[model samples]
Target: MPKSNTIPVVLTIAGSDSGGGAGIQADIKAISATGSYAASVITAITSQNTLGVLDILPIPLAHIESQLDAVFQDLNIVAVKIGMLADADIINLVADKLEQYQPKHIVLDTVMVATSGDLLLKETAIGSLKDRLLPLASIITPNLPEAAALTGLAEPKDAEQIEHMVTAMRQLSTSAVLLKGGHLEASDESDDLLITQNETHRLSTERIRTPNTHGTGCTLSSTIASFLAQGEDMLSAVSHAKQYITQAIGHADLLKVGQGRGPVDHFFMLHQ
Candidate 1:
């Protein structure tokens, strides 16, 4: 076990992306990049690369429980980032753990499908994610497809339609909803909608044209958790995460990792 210290600790519960661009690998990289210690509890293993996902194997629920128990018992985990829970059972187990540990910051990247058009979560678990896990998160970061899945909004064509989607998601839980517009068909800027219980914020950044946006959602959510673990408020955390991911996407072309869509440069700032 690593020695306990005052350094902020962030925990991630997600799948393992063998490609190392997303899931637990991306979470660790993003958290560490934010100067926070990262611990992980993997819920599934995925055989994937920039091209596509080949297969997915969900971890046993008991093993997932054990990992969560070990971390919460030892580490003062300040924030948790959850991603790619494979089934309803896995989602329930994760929710139970969060209930037990009650970490201060919880960021849920509602990862439904990969950038390569592969489904990450089972169809049967969608209801469970909305009914059980959505309520527990401090915030949920969902791209257009994920938001549509949760809210039954299909494709939100205009700003008013997008607002309707956001309202539907906010109705699910008191937790804040971060509806990401990255998946939308936009020509200029990608805007993100952050809707809290009492406030609504629209954040926009100039879109960096890159094919290396494979794990952008995972990176953003984990980075938000990292900032929250560092004692920043939710609004500040989201803002900083957006800035960090913009820089990462800007540097994506520098790293020649895979044949198809590559990964964002998580440590680009370090190389500067």
Candidate 2:
């Protein structure tokens, strides 16, 4: 029997977190909570909890290829959210599949580091991600440090420096860049700059203070993908995603999941 296409399907290509706070787990939860069916291809598996990552096991390249083929062949995927790529080989392979399959909206969350201060991607993979995957993405969501790493500049210390960093990032091949400013601890307001080829839009939301902020990047990017899968424009998708993540973070304090950082309430509305 043919599958129904009434509901939009969003694909997440990332790692797996045993703790279910980030990566494939978070992506699935966010996508489903945002009103879309979620599909996934895990690039790596991490023995991770809210505290930190203990070990990482790479999915064999052939198995990764098989997984990509299986999904692209069968699923009616409208959008893709790409997260952590452990090395250059995996990056190249994902780039190849993306180019071959050509999903309509590809949101790349440059997942280089985890909230636990653990490294998720290797330094050697940066060049491959830049040369290969960046060009294929519809938009990239990068936090300050990831943006700095991509552009070879220090992390932006202020709004002016942020603009400068975005200017440098403009040379990259992606259609747009969402430079997340949540890392600026001094700010009461969180401002993320959306840089398109035509114009730049500033997305600002109140910074909610909470100890539970794990999976924020994954959740935000997946939510954006869900919106895009549902036919929202670039700016609208990003705007809605920002609003959603803020609420999720604001409600995060209500849930006590882990000893360290905790996951956001992907289904926060249900609790309301």
Candidate 3:
């Protein structure tokens, strides 16, 4: 194993969630919780809480590029987790930067909508995200809503439907797709499918019943990137990430930060 002091670094390129439940905040927390250093590039800012997003202000493209350059110049960023790029220009800029820096692993959470049903990504940018960013990702984690938007399919309601969506999404040329089934809340179990070019792994767990699932996607993807940065392969990284998210979600009700959907306990281990 690498020296303990040489912790792998994971960079998150995304938006700022002022509520601290999702976006860059969640990414940093999950990365740190999973034993990696975290760096961030905030492409946008959202005034949001567990209730919903009320406003969005996208950062300038030049500044986003500068943040990417600044982080890549010094830190040894082994993996990258990309969340909300709010527009077409931001998507192109991030894709260009990824082309330039060429991080070893890229986990793209196609963040289109929030947990409270607020749209975070511009519909106009979806085409650009597919054309530029999807091809570059090591894996793309799309929940039911995002998968439907990306693949032009209906939102999944079951494990079989989610797998079907993954099959459709693979045509977009992504090397891997982690189709998240968390939004199928009516089911007794959560099924996340990891579909790669050659294999498909079904990862199922008992669904934790709670409204405090805000930031779950960001947390999972960033944690997966962290594990990858720490030298775990794709399947192992995803499996470990699943375990981490389950634990986080199971402990989420312990936090009373919001009146509506609360956040997962990213530092649940510390709280023990």
Candidate 4:
């Protein structure tokens, strides 16, 4: 148990990544790294490693609802980070829970596919997410591919096209959209665009050359939610979270974990 004022509690509703690289595990680690208490309502369990997902066992909707109830009933949840919803029912369940609890901030990581190119959410879930979850999100973070999928656009090849895609995504979600540029090809810099109700801002960083980026998206979204839980405004929270993930990627240890791509060292800055 944490002191009432001391621990800022953040809840993550996502899948479990057995690789410990991404998903709920990464969310918890990122939350803790930012000095926030982490709680979880797991949507699915994956038999996966850095290489790929071998199997997926989705938790029943009832159980997921129970988990949400158990946490929100007791804890003062300050913020939420959502990831890896496996189906429409689960997405609706989460949306209903969010509506009931109304956490201060909601970071929606539109986790459509895995890093290894596996589709994580079902086809019907896509519609449910857009119709139900998008409006409730405080910030929706989608990588290039996911953004393209959500907006039904062919992948944008240039920054201008990417901006167009971001504009399209803004219409779908009432919240701020952070369209990540990790998968986009670039000559000089990797850039992420933040489009909100008020303005569109670009955040550029020197692209880190590393394969050890297994959980970067999950880590970044959770980091932002944690900062929001700690009372940072949306833009400042996102800015700091971007800086944190960049440093994590840069300092990623080349540990040959699982004989494939490895995870960013979330604990890297602490041990340094």
Which candidate leads in lDDT?
2
TM-scores for every predicted model:
0.96, 0.97, 0.97, 0.96
Q: What are the clashing pairs of model 2?
A: none
Q: Write the per-residue lDDT of candidate 1 for residues 88-136, one digit (tens) a residue.
A: 9999999988998899888999989999989998888999998888888
lDDT tens digits by residue: candidate 2, 1-272: 99866999999999999999999999999999999999999999999999999999999999999999999999999999999889999999999999899999999999999999999999999999989989989999999999999998999998889988877878888999999999997889999999988789999988888879999999999999999999999999999999999999999988899899999999999999
Select the stronger candidate by TM-score from 2 and 4.
Answer: 2
For candidate 3, the per-residue lDDT at 62 reads 90
Compared with the true structure, all predictions reach lDDT values of 0.90, 0.94, 0.93, 0.90
Clash count list over all predictions: 0, 0, 0, 0
| Global fold similarity of model 1 (TM-score) | 0.96
Model 3 lDDT tens row, 1-272: 86557889999999999999999999999999999999999999999988999999999989999999999999999999999999999999899889998999999999999999998888999999999999999999998889899989898877678767767977877899998888888899998889987788989999899989999999999999999999999999999999999999999999888899999999999889
In model 3, the Cα lDDT at residue 142 comes to 93
Relative to the unseen true structure, what is the Cα RMSD of model 2? Answer: 2.1
Lowest summed-lDDT stretch of 10 residues in model 4?
251-260
As a whole number from 0 to 100, the lDDT of residue 9 in candidate 2 is: 94
lDDT tens per residue, model 4, 119-171: 89987778899999999999999998888888899888888788778668768
Error of 4 at 14 (Å): 0.5
